[model samples]
Target: MDLTTLTYIVVGFTFALYIGIAIWARAGTTGEYYVAGKGVNPVANGMATAADWMSAASFISMAGLIAFMGYDASVYLLGWTGGYVLLAMLLAPYLRKFGKFTVPEFIGDRFYSKTARVIAVVCLIVASLTYVIGQMKGIGVAFSRFLETDYTTGLFIGMAIVFFYAVLGGMKGITYTQIAQYVVLIFAYTVPAIFISLQLTGNPLPQLGLGSTLEAGGGGYLLQTLDRILVDLGFTQYTTMEEGNGFNMMMLTMSLMIGTAGLPHVIVRFFTVPRVRDARKSAGWALVFIAILYTTAPAVGAMSYFNLINTVKPGEVGAEASNLLYEERPDWFKNWEQTGLLAWEDKNGDGRIQYYNDGNEQFAQTATEQYGWQGNELTVDRDIMVMANPEIANLPNWVIALVVAGGLAAALSTAAGLLMAISSAVSHDLIKGIFNPGISEKGELLSARLAMAGAVLFAGYLGLNPPGFAAQVVALAFGLAASSLFPVLMLGIFNKRMNSAGAMTGMLVGLTSTLVYIFTYKGWLFIPGTNMLPNTAEYWFLGIQPESFGALGALLNVTAAYLVSKVTAPPPEHIQHLVEDVRVPRSAKEAPAH
Candidate 1:
């Protein structure tokens, strides 16, 4: 079958499977909706968590970003997976032992203060909404590119699918669907990686092949060749250090790490398992799955760079670089062209496309004169790299179809989880806990479904008018998480005296400072041209960009919490006992009867 037919088949069948799972595991009570009744096996929950966390960014954009940005992209790799280590070792087990259905529930009961709980709720909402915006946008971009639909229409379709499973089954349906999604997405992600690795390095594994010799240049270090070609084309070496200010890169990496730890959608996944030990084990398992992608990405980037440069060099295909015609474009080039992702212009009268890093000072003049080029005209978005790679490598049509399913799975699974978080907060924390203390389980479940529907509408609207690229807005989400939610949870667990006053004050301070910093540089909510920073060195704080400031925000949060706590009376003995109870999971009782 052809690519289009195969895509419809694969995506259609996967949708059918998900819908089937939703029907099978439909939520019947509030417990099922909120926590999947806390009955999921550790391994299954771990796989589900992996699917919920990966998203379109992992399956579609991460390799592409690594391919183009080279070393600068390491921050994403380290920051995202490293957060799992913190969650596994520090946060997940304790939260699971506390045995609450949602994150806010734990915070509220732990502090014995409804106000503290509300502040925590606000922090979760901000982090989750920002995070979900990126996922919805990713879904829209994927559908528009592959399904041949407009972005807004694609978003509505995606939202409809999410609503079908999420509103009906809640976390129970979401968990099984996510496990299925994990299987599909991983296969989708790795199949292309394997194909590309074999083509470029004669190795089947992308991770090992990245460090292997370059098949394109006969026999040379792949990274070394990429570095040389990039330098020749006015770009930086793909394997070496970046020339951007050292402090800024350091700050940026740190910020991404804290933000990873702080994200609400990811943290809430840990609460679904049965035991504290299982929660910790599940976090480790999630990391194991994530690492498979992280380890292979750098290799994919190196090989792709070499492949891209080989396509541009003169005399390779018996065609003049200056007179190459559009009809003769490679299949990968033609494929992406249909999606409007790859474009070219003969700026220098040279028909060949040149896409160097645009950072090599030594070759800058040569680039301008030899090519007669004003600037690079190729406009391939970073999100296209992994999604389009199978087509790029001339893989089978079925593999290409798998790619489409994989992208959808990545986006939809995460969306389901995020919606679950939003709904649980509304129904359990806000309604049952506060508004209607006598509410029945059935009534709470009804509220959860309504909240899910409303949240999806709000998120779809954001996707229709995406503030920026998915990854860029996601960074802001991480910063918010790092600064606000992470510190409060950490102090609440490990420290005995972190009272309601301290946790409350710290969350506000951290939230405000991080938001102010981001708004100052990214504009109030990332609207362009309204920012206070020059968006350049002249206005940066010690050369650090606002995007890389989340780590500092986390520091501010911990500092504020500590300072405020010391000035106030210590938390009551009962709260300290709660902390102790969380640590010793073996001594626990069953979750309080609903």
Candidate 2:
């Protein structure tokens, strides 16, 4: 079958699988809707958590980002995975023992203040909404390519599919659906990595292939060869760190780690398991599943870069015959060009495509004078790297179809989880907990569904008119979560003396600080043309990127909470007992009194 037909079939099959799972595991109660009735097996929950955490950015864009950013991209790998360790050790088991349906509920009960719960809900919404915007954009890109639809149309279709499964099944449905999604997405991601790895290095494992010698008769390791080619083409060396990228990489890693631990969607995953021990084991299993793709990603990045350089320069780098003739470009090139993702302008009318660093002033002289070149002629979107990698390496149509399915799976699974987080906060925390304490279970469930529908529409809107930081918005989302949610949650559990006043004050301070810093550079609320200053390291406070500012915000939260707690009365005796009970798993599993 052709690419289009195969894509349709594969993507169609995955959708059917998800819908089937949703139908099979439909929620029957608010507990099921919120936490899958707290009965999911540890291993299954772990896989589901992996699917939920690995967003479209991880599946579709991360390898591509690493391909371009080189070693600098290690921050993402470290930061994201590192946070899970923190969650498993410091957060997950205790939270699971607490047995709350939502993150805001824990904060509210721990602080003994409805006001604190409301603040936590707002923080969860802000963090989750920002995160969902990125997922929606990813869905649009994946659908637009494989399904041959416009972005807006693709987004709506994706939203509809999410609504079907997410609204009907809630946590119960989504958990099983995500397990299926994990299988499909992981298989799709690894198959291409294996194919390309074997093609370049005679090794089937991409992680091993990255370190192996090239099969193309290159003189050194594959990374060494890649580095040589990139440097020759005036790009950063593929394996070495480039100088002067914005932000401290360590600090950036910490922010992402904290953000990962703090994200309501992720933390809530632990609540679905049957026991606190299961929560701990589930976290470890999640890391194992995630590491499969994470370890292979660098290999995919390196191989794709190697393949692109070799395709464009089939011979010696500067030779006239080395460039791929514009008219003779492959079918894959034409295919992407139609989507406007890959473009070329034959500057100087050379009739050849030059893929090089045209912005490198030091190399411009040699490029133009010696080679008769007129700067770089091609503009390939970084987001297309992984999607295009299979075609670039001449992989079969089925592999490409699987990639489309994988991207969709990754995007949709995370989007569903985030929407669930948003809706639960609105319905369970805000409405049922505070506004209408007497709300019936039936009314609460309806409210949750309505809240979910509204969140989907709002997220879709944000996807269309995305912020300036849309490309890097996942990192920003992490920042917001780390700053606002993680610290407060950690304090609530570990600091029994922490009062509602302190928790509330800490959350507001952390949230405001992160937002102010981000908006100052990324535009006020990311509005176009509203930035107070250019988003550059030179203009940053203490040379921190807005992405890394989460660490600072987190620090402020801790300090502010501590100082405020010293001046305020300690949490009531019951609240202290509640904290102690959460710290140690109890048999009764009842909510402690206020």
TM-score of each: 0.94, 0.96
Task: For candidate 2, list the clashing residue pairs, or say none.
Answer: none
Best by lDDT: 2
List lDDT for all candidates, in order.
0.79, 0.89
lDDT of 1 by residue, 1-594 (tens): 777777888999999999999999999987788888888888888899999989876666677778887888887787788778888888887787777888788888888888887787788887778778888877876787678786778789999999999999999999999999999988887887788889888889988888888676568877776777666566666766677566777777777777777676677777777766778888888888877767877876666656655654533322345334556768778766766667887666655565543445545556666555556657777777766677666788888888889889999998888888888888888888878989988899999999999989888876665556566667777888888988888998899889888888889998888888877877865566888876767787777677777778888889988999999999899889878766654334544322
TM-score of candidate 1 against the unseen true structure: 0.94
User: For residues 1-594, what per-residue lDDT tens digits would candidate 2 score against the true structure?
Assistant: 889999999999999999999999999899999999999999999999999999987887788778888898889899999999999999998888777899999988788888999999999999999898888878877777778887789899999999999999999999999999999999989999999999988999999999999887654799888778788889888777768664588789999999999999999999998877899999999999999989988998888878877777777777888889988988888888877767999887889888888879878778888887788888877777888899999999999999999988998999999999999999999999999999999999999999999999998888876663233678889999999999999998888888888888999999999999998998866678898989877898888888888999999998999999999898889888878877764456644322
* Pairs of residues at least 3 apart in sequence or in different chains that clash in candidate 1: 255-551
Q: Candidate 1 vs. truth: CA RMSD? A: 2.6
Residue 308 displacement in candidate 1 (angstroms): 3.2
